[model samples]
Target: MTDYAFSSVNQLANDFKDAIKNADDDQKKVLKKAQAKFSLIERNYQIITNLYNNNMVDEQRPLYFFPSSQRLVAGKEEKGNAKLIVPFEFVGKKLYYGLTATGTHDLNPMPFNPRYPMVGLHANALNTILDNKLIHEVSKAWVVLIIIILGVVLAFGIPSLSPVQGGATIGGLLIGYTYLCFWLFSSQHIWLDLFGPAITMAVGYLGITIYNYIQEEKNKQFLKESFGTYVSPELIDQMYESGEEPSLGGEEGYHTAFFTDIQSFSAFSEKLSATDLVSLLNEYLTDMTDVLLDNKGTLDKYIGDAIVAFYGAPIEIENHELWACKTAIIMQDNLELLRQKWQSEGDRWPEIVHHMQNRIGINTGQMVTGNMGSASRMNYTMMGDTVNLAARLEASAKQYGIYIQIADTTYQPVKDQIVIRDLDFVRVMGKTEPAQVYELISETGQEPELYKKILPAFHEALALYRNQEWNNAIEAFKASDELEDMFPGRKTNPSRIYIPRCEHYRDNSPGDDWDGAWTLTSK
Candidate 1:
């Protein structure tokens, strides 16, 4: 019976071998076709990489194939029992598969066993499982969708919530989810999508946080750019640290306004080439702006050769008028030094021989001050009659031949620190009320006695004029003008034009209710 069984098994084994041969032939044909297709695909990938000058790793190339072989082995004890084993290798990696079969004819593909004393079969099964897992994990759209959702939720939700609350929630969720997934995957051999969702969420949160931090820095940069030009660096630093932003509209405030312009800048500019002209102007503006900023003033704007600036707005300053007056004196002193330097440079210097003479006017009043302009653009500035009056005072400096003049209101506060002469009390070209103009003659150290002598007499003359004593007032002014001439190198020469105007006003008596104020007809 056993012999008969052996014969039967042998016949079955032979038939099964024939079947395997036939299957092998069919598989060979299929492999040849697959190889051709894979070769074409690999060539195409190489062509693309070459065109782009890309040096990609060989493993990264997508075209790949697996070559496998199977065999049947008969067992010694049982007639019909035999073993089937399949082996596979790819890219230098080995794979193996093995299973028990009743006969070669009944042999079939089977699940792998790692400890079945068949290394090739074990390796083949492992490779198959790994490949299937990779493909399945990558191809599933639901996994990708979940990753995207998690990324979105992390990015948008984290920053919006309080830091404490958001961080705790995210930390707990990540820990619990990761633990659960790992437990399931390691113990039950179940694969879960881990890398995509976790990586996406982490990157999204980090990206959003970094982006917000960058935006905050940009805002700080913008603030520095906008206001740094006007205010002091210390003040700007304070503003930035305080986290308060400047408004784009004007606010009413009590401020000390200062205006300055180069005397006869037009004729001087016309003499130089455009490049030299710009350079010269820039030098003067830069020097003056430095002085203004040092004194904590807000530079409003530059009107041609003029600089209009103010103090005690955007930020409050206690002694704004004093600072403004000090700035003017410093500017005048600095100009003298600059002029000497230019003169020493000799003929190479431009023919326009400018002496760095400046006319400065200051006034203290309630004015509108802020950044004002269209939605797209704006500038820190001041507006109102006080600003206009300050400008008019600068213009009037040419008539008085003075370096600096201040409205009576502006001078009233800082009169002790400065030596000033009451130059005039007349209605400016655009105003009905009389504004007393004072010449800022000197500071404490320089020309104190001369300023003292000149200012008293000048004030007496102004008092005479205001009291309607014409003849005596004219005599006082003539005396004052003479005294100014005696000090030959005085910063500003007294205007002869004013002598005539004062004489005319004295000769013709203004109306009875006249407050001894002269009217101006032109700007």
Candidate 2:
């Protein structure tokens, strides 16, 4: 009997060794497969970690890791040994064992199965069914629906209440929900999906807030780009802060349009080298433009040597027409000073023997003013018949020899403050209705006594010319030209050109229907 027992013990030891060898080989293969699969899952885990770390989904909790020291064992009846234990240090926490006939039969002291109760088969079967039913119910479609509805109501309803009430409502709900979920999970071993709805709410709110912030910044940049040239920087910032965009479209308001160009600039530029001509133009335009800016006029556009600008609109000035007229006079005055300075410095200035003067034309009327052009290219400008008339008057100044001319339409409004001499009534180039052009002689403060005296005589001559007394009008113009410090030396010759033309027309009359208004056939 002792020999038999010893042999049996030896046989058991051999079987155990064989099993260990096979299990180790199987474990290695299983571990290699697990590592490969886990490697793929680990990469996904890293992506999730990075997203969470970046606060991409602020309310979602990060994943938890089970400790590496934990282990799992199998075989319920094996008292002092385990079939397999993973991460062996956690074995002491509590080893879960599955009962089987092999385990009870091999270690012959008839080990008990912890999984079974002493109760009959029906009771065990009933408990298994209950556990399965509970899992199924928890994972049902209705359960997911409930969670979604709860999230929506909380997110929308909380913000609808007063601030303090909303805060209290949300806080109380969050605390109660968290506590309930924790208690259910710990005591009943049931898992609740807390993170999903919370993440949805957080992401939706954050997305809207971020989008609005970006839009606001874009609006600020647009405002700065649009109005920087016309308004002060501080006021621009204030408008941006207040979120008000200035209307850049057309407005119905009175404004003065000033158009000016160098007389015979194209012919003059042909005589000089390109570099010298460009430099000269730059010098002249810079001085003139500075004067325009000083008078609070918007420099609308420049067409080569010509400057087209306006007063009022974009920002309104009460004396817009007055400002425009004042700027033109100042520009003429500045040019005289510039000519003297250039001559003293030994610069080759353009000849003024025949005619070389800036002829400015101003008109006040309704015009469509705004940024006008295609989507890709646009310019802030004023457009209408009034703008065209201003240009036509500028061209007309060359014909009649005047420094500045305003239409009768323009002169009517500011007649109280300005002294003007009616030069001519002509259907200027493109229009059928005759326009009376008047030279802006002086302002109320700087009215020259000589201009005041000769201006009345010139108008009387103009009235006679309109009535077909061409010979008498010529005599009056010649006398006014000779008046001391009246029309000046350079300007007198150009005024003299019109007298010979009038004499020729008078000699060969154009019948009773002729209105005595000269029409320009060509530019």
Q: Which prediction has the highest lDDT against the true structure?
A: 1
- Model 1 agreement with the true structure over 1-523: per-residue lDDT tens digits: 1132334534644544454456667765554444444444555555656545644334343322335233334243243223221121133564343444444342444465323334455565687687664322334587778787787788677778765777676777678768866876766556667766777766776687788789878876887788877787876766776665556687888998999988778877677788877877888889899999998888888888889899887777789999899899889888878777777888745545535578898999999988788888888888988888988988887767777989988988877777787677778887888988888877655755666676777778777777777778778878887767533223445534456766777777775787656666665
Could you tell me the lDDT of residue 243 within candidate 1? Answer: 65
Clash totals for all models, in order?
Answer: 7, 1
Candidate 2 residue pairs that clash? 71-86
TM-score of each: 0.57, 0.53
Candidate 2 lDDT, 1-523, residue by residue in tens: 1132434534644544554456667775654444344444544566557656766545443232356443444443223223332232242353333333444432223135534422334454566576663422256465568567766765677545654675566567667767866777767767766665455445644554465568778886776687555434554566676655435655656788899998778776777778877887888888888887777777787899999888775566677888888888899888888767766655465444123468899988888777777878877788888898899888778666677989887788788998887777678778888777788877876877777777776667667666778888788767766652533323443246557756977897767898667766643
**In TM-score terms, which candidate is top?**
1
In angstroms, give how far residue 490 of model 2 lies from its true place.
4.1
Backbone clashes (count) for model 1? 7
The ten-residue window of minimal lDDT in model 2 covers 80-89
